[model samples]
Target: MDALSQALAKSRQTISAYEDYAERYDQIVRHVPNEREQASLKRLVAIAGTAGQILEVGSGAGYDADFLEALGVKVRRTDATKRFLELQAARGKHGELLDLLTDDLGGPYDAVLALAVLIHVPRDQIEQVLAKIAGSLRPGGAFLVSMRNGDGETDGNYHTVLWRRDDFAARIESAGLVLIRDDFNEGRNREEWNTFLAVRPA
Candidate 1:
């Protein structure tokens, strides 16, 4: 197979392994609490200007979803991992299996939360995914995403792409979104991750 196809195949296999790993996946992760995640959620709430319908893509274990709901925001969660999706469903949470890399799932949300999820997307396809995410939001709606910050390449059984800050920002902007804030924090893995809060341009 070509290099791109090979990479995609490898990525799918890695993600499938993660599905089987379930909560145990955290064991391999840095176990670092994402401060950017906390900050971004606060900004999202502020941009939303009150409780409103929010869509969270890659809502692993529904942690952020539950957090948002607890904060009085209505949250609809979705993830690409079937096992993770099922786990969220089993908890009586609202969520679905969704692949942002694909076109249109549902839409016009007040805001879209995608913390730490985009890292799984292949670098070449990041723009496509971002565009699809932007389309899911209403004009002036916000989109929050976080990714590992690095100039080097890294692969994992689950994560396919690691991105640099400038490159990721350029793609988000090209998707017709305006970045409102960008923050970074040290991860438990000893790597940095960037969180971006953006709005679909009106």
Candidate 2:
């Protein structure tokens, strides 16, 4: 396996370690919004406009799902973490259990929200994942993706693969998604993150 792929495999193990922590994920995250999750959510909602069917990938504790639903959006939630999926299912929002790297999650969604999820994917595989997400959307559908800003692999401990913003945007564009908006925000002790809004070309 390639270096990036190997790193990703190790990262999956790191994520699995959090399986028992599902019930507490939301609480833990609330203590620190690691990235600018709240800001990203607001941007996503605005870009989604009048949401129809929305898909949320890596829906950890279903916080985004809850917010989207509260906004009258229909959310189909999915996660690779089985424990998280169980938690979502328990809350009655588990639309599908999916490994974004492997699943054929068919969709013609109006919007796809992948908050803090793509960071777990290996750098080399991110383009493929973005393409899959792009393919899942309807023509002109919106895609929201967030990632930490930098380059190279982080130690699989945090489930993050640091990436550069421009490079990532290039990948998304190559995947048939047109960039709409990109923003950076600092939150809760100056933690920085990037959010990108794109639309599949009709």
Candidate 3:
């Protein structure tokens, strides 16, 4: 990784930036789910059912959770950033403080969602993180994740360690999850983003 990537990866571990930006970020993004995300949610519902026990990692400000709730799904919302949880509390919602790398996930959940979340994991540790996510699921549980896809990011402090699809898929399989398919889009800032759905075997 280059200097920017190094800095971004380091920043991801320090939650202070998130602590200060949580409210402001929510103000900017706390809207209904976007089209692609809505599609992913619908697919997840199809696989996991509407009422599946879902554990959502990085549920910032509960934006996507609000939409999933409307579909009769209850989400165990969690984030590493305390401020995001506080903001969710301000919205009269509740969530837990979870660090996927070190904390006990407490599942066997029916499904797991980690939208734009796993990018925070350093590249070397992503396999371990992916394994934990898979292990946290029930035998037939579904998993949905989106991340910045590439080797690096142009943004100075905001971008996390990026990913390549092939590398990610290999890790997903190595972690014991069955890869379904993946989708990609050039995001607003020319950020290469990719989303993939996978499942644990029954």
Candidate 4:
């Protein structure tokens, strides 16, 4: 199979596995939040404030959604996995099924938060997906993203498209979003992550 096709297949399998693990996802996660996650959430919520809606792609266990809502940001949570959406629904919050490469993300949202989600998008389709995300945002709207930083692709439980920092920045700007803040986090086992806050020009 071609690279994109292989990545899609792995994405499907990974989503299924995550669906099965949905109920236990939060429970199985480390009690201590990752510093990067906390930092990103703080920045996003601060930007969101009391006005405007935020769209969170790959909501997973809805942890970020919970934090944003508690901070008074109107958030719409979405994931590609059905069971994960169900878990969010069970918490008295609804979530939508969103396929970043295929689905329409109905929005001109004030902010778009996609933490560690685009890492799963295949390389060939990454630019298109980024454009689609940028198109969903309003002018001056923020896009907060975090993804694993490395070289080449890997597949196992899910597909990962590792990226160099400059190439990733180029992709973001090429999609018409200007970079605002950029940073990196070094983790255990060489798991370095790239975080960025980009915005559509007002």
Best of the candidates, lDDT: 4
- The Cα local distance difference test for each model comes to 0.77, 0.77, 0.84, 0.85
Kindly report which residue pairs in candidate 4 clash with one another: none
Please give each candidate's TM-score. Answer: 0.87, 0.85, 0.90, 0.90
The alpha-carbon deviation from the true structure for residue 82 of candidate 4, after best TM-score superposition, in angstroms, is 1.1
Show the lowest summed lDDT stretch of 10 residues, model 1: 25-34
Candidate 2's displacement at residue 72, Å, is 1.5
Say which prediction, candidate 1 or candidate 4, comes out ahead on lDDT: 4
Q: Give the per-residue lDDT of model 3 (tens digit) for 1-202.
A: 7754554456464566788888788878738988888999988877878878799999988988888888888899999899999988988999999987678898889899999888877676788789999999999899999888888643445547788988888888999999997999887678788889999999
> Distance (Å) between predicted and true CA of 121, model 1?
0.5
- For residues 1-202, write the lDDT of model 1, one tens digit per residue: 7756765676677669768887775445433334656666878977765667898888877777776777788888887778887776777876787776553758788899987778877777677778888888888899888888886455666654777888889999999999888887787659788888899877
Q: Single out the weakest 10-residue window by summed lDDT for candidate 4.
A: 28-37
Better of 1 and 2 by TM-score: 1
How would you order the candidates by lDDT, starting with the best?
A: 4, 3, 2, 1
